[model samples]
Target chain A: MVCRVILPRQFRAPELFPQVQREFGRLERIPNHVQFDFSQLQFARPSGVVFLSNLTRYLRRNGCRVTYCGLDPSRDPIAYMDDSLFFEQHCGRRLLDSSQPRPTTRPLMEIRHTEVHGWIGFQLIPWLSASSGVPETELAEFRTCMSELFNNIQDHTEYDVGSVFAQWYPQEHKLEIVVADFGSGIPRTVRTVEAIDSDANAILRSFDEGFSAKSRPTNRGAGLHYLRQNVLDNLGGNLRVHSGSGVVRFEKNGNSHQVKLCEGSGFCPGTMVELEIRTDRIEFDEVNDGSFEW
Target chain B: MVVVVKDLVSSCDTNYDGMVVHKHVLSALHGTDSVVVDFSGIPNVTSSFVNCAFVALLQDFDFAQIRSRLHLQNVNRQIGNLVRDRMKKEAATVA
Candidate 1:
């Protein structure tokens, strides 16, 4: 029997997840044939596009035959989805709804962990820099922040594939990047190594410097900490991490930082790291001028 | 001996690449008085890279030995901070 997932009109994350989780939260629960009904999807956020693409891949990886229905290229959301390469990455085919992926769209990508460095340096950094006026030099820190998240996903997740969706909004001078994967989340992974009482606590604790999910604990825990520091604290960007049922959001409020931890952000399969960068605000790094400090 | 990071890995990002750098650094240390890791062309690196390439060295060599033997050149604040932060933590644990 086929399970038809009728998506909501506003097809975005932090909301779409809970509804979908009710369908395929566990591997044992996936139906033989899963059909994603995107007819009702009127608005698609980067997070939602990447999440759905990732969920589809996850289902297929678990032996589910995934199919899409109710795609109307004439609709604004469908056209946007086409421009984002959502259907292309999802099915290796495009609706040809738009002339091309468009210059403003970063396009969706399913990058293996091994290819992350190249993707970030060769494609992601250049794309973000081109649209946002964020110098590549200043974006180096952003690259480091992203690399840290990739490191976390590589170390913690069972899947090697990470689906990414990025969009550069030039008018707003903002860049949105979302990377999602089908792996054991921060909570489940942290629970393996430490005695964390809750998912929110596990994610929050991961932010502590020198915390690693490795059972023996190597030099492995700085990914989340550095990400939180650089993206939220240093650069005044936004960072949201969704894994298991935990959601950690970092927002800058005047001089103070807003750290919100939600224990019930629903079940986000694997983990999703979403970043909204104020591309106009990035500046050059002044310290550590190519010298070692002993 | 100078271990140019770009020469070791096309992109300094993954654990496998980090391990590759670690082995090369170990070999360089054995063959020379000191090894300077050149991070000129590499834009940014991850903690996995730093931990495997630099911090793990603390286990085999003390902080003093690391300070004396292993050096970093062209290290930006981003990569340098990751290496230093991780190395300090591992060095403390070893001590």
Candidate 2:
């Protein structure tokens, strides 16, 4: 038996994710052969490509013979993925001849949690510093955010590995980052802490400050709370988390946040965290060094 | 005893590394009146690392004992606050 799932025309994430879950989430028992058709994919964001890469990984790990077809490297969308090194990293095949990542984007990558601190220091921070107004020292603050997500993947997920992609949109003055993994969803991990009604509620409640992202039963800023406080609240940007059959989108309002929910939208395996950070609000935050008081 | 954190060459991000640091520091605490942990070079750290390495000590030692014995040197406000917040939260959760 074989299953063919054609890729979407507009490959954009936080939106493309639910549609994918609806298509592939139910098929835990995948057919022996699975063909991912990228013929219609016209445009793709860095975050969206991370989802696609993780989807392919999950399918293959489930004992399915996965293959991709209907790709034209000459086209912009397929070429973009090639330039980002998505195919080479995900499929061991290059779609284009160039080996460099695109201008404002980092290449799609899979990294283990243990190596994330160094990766952020050596790879991610330098790239962001080169492309933005934020200096490397100040931008290093974002390393805590990455560390939080990586720690969650290490503690909660079946695999300690995570798929990451990032891009800076200079025109929009914003940064979009996607960190994803194929593991048990956030709702399952939350269930271990508190009793919740829906998966969306589970994720929403998990955002409470002082609550650890995983099992420590400690209130730490290194988990979802830091993501909310640092990005959505301070920068007045947006954060989207999709886990299981539910999705929650939080956008910064004047002082608070606007929460949008899409519950019961088919089960999505694992969790994906998307952050749209406002670069204008970005400044060096690690500047205060005077007092260690209190 | 003085511990220079930069010399550890540790990742200081994941729980596994956190546990390693915890064990090392705990061993350093034995038979010593106090241990000074220096963070001159390392600029930032994750809560996960602080939790495993410092907050976990609350399990074995009281806060005052930790305060008297575990003195950190040359840490930024962010690191101080993280240790404080994790300690308060863990104590609250335990209570």
Candidate 3:
């Protein structure tokens, strides 16, 4: 027996017990003892929780033999399986208002050189902000920019050694995300965007279009470009990039400021991105649901 | 074969009969001469189902063996027209 699972695109899986029962009834001619195969299903929203629960219940009630394949068997199911985890940790985080006294002043958590996975970054940022009482809007922007930067580091930085260290200052209303590695830097990532090794300035120019690096697959290369627009241009944040001894500082709604490279103190062999998101005016209610006692 | 017929959408529950349909259309075409494949209940045919059912069978059976023996019966007007207009495009790619 075969139970072909069709993956739905929408976020919510409306329980269709009637439809499922009808489908099963129509296929009742098949013997009960035959083995059941479930394949080719994809989940689009709320991650996978609702669907899994419904499927498990249906299969159990039917007394059908079932086999599952092709599902991404990640060890930690909650990270991807729970849709709320992404929002609670990323988009809905709280940011301290620019006007209020900072609620949390802890240094940004530092994750150095161990490869930064997407989920880890997704979990870490909001995890850090939980203490700060960040505003929701700022948290959303932070999640977007942070996702782009973390993805860039994962895709671009291929090296012998690497690390990321970050600290968020509530009093200053700024978050510093620093990723450094002793490997190929942005200059190398730039080469794939264009044919020439164009000087550091031209390389920086490539960032304006948010073009993706040709060397990588499935990349929306606009991570840095998006970071530039939302963080700096839209939200009045700051972006600083240092690649191969070339330093460029970008302030929201301002001209690109080029500065002399300091003697490799903040610079090492890889890329270190420092982004300051202003969050001094936001209140705690804006950051969290105000349901948790912590 | 259970065909799920919804206007403009047809989903076939070929779960049990899929293997038979696969074998007839791919290798033993003559083996299915007495049987007619019914997609009347299918309202919409999806790629995921096709990929899971039809495309998968092609891996084990050869096409020439079952082309003529496989038959689609009770094709509804709305579903049939929909198939002609929309599914035809996909059929070309899948075929």
In the range A118-190, model 1's lDDT, one tens digit per residue, is 7888888898788777678777778988887887877668777898888878888887889888888878878
- What is the Cα-based lDDT of residue A232 in candidate 3? 61
Q: Candidate 2's residue-wise lDDT over A1-294, tens digit each? A: 667878778886655665666666555556788787889998888767888888788778888788888888888888888888888877787975665687798778888876777888888878877787776656534667777767765566888788888998998878888888878888888888788889998888878776555465543534667666767755547888888888888887788788988887656678888878766776555566634533
Candidate 2 clashes between residue pairs 3 or more apart in a chain or in different chains: A210-A219
The C-alpha RMSD of each candidate to the native structure, in angstroms, is: 2.6, 3.0, 25.0
DockQ for all candidate structures vs. native: 0.64, 0.37, 0.01
Error of 3 at B33 (Å): 34
Provide the overall lDDT of each model, using Cα atoms, as 2-decimal numbers: 0.81, 0.75, 0.41
Flag the better candidate by lDDT, 1 or 2: 1
C-alpha TM-scores of all predictions? 0.90, 0.87, 0.40
Interface RMSD of each: 2.0, 3.3, 21.7
Q: Of 1 and 2, which scores higher on TM-score?
A: 1
Q: Rank by TM-score, highest first.
A: 1, 2, 3
Residue A207 lDDT, candidate 3, scale 0-100: 63
Query: What's the C-alpha lDDT at position A276 in model 3?
Result: 62
Residue A245, model 1, lDDT = 82
| lDDT per residue as tens, model 1, B1-95 | 88898887887777777889999998888788889999998887887787778877776777898888888999777777778877787788777
Q: Between prediction 2 and prediction 3, which has the larger DockQ?
A: 2
Top of the candidates by TM-score: 1
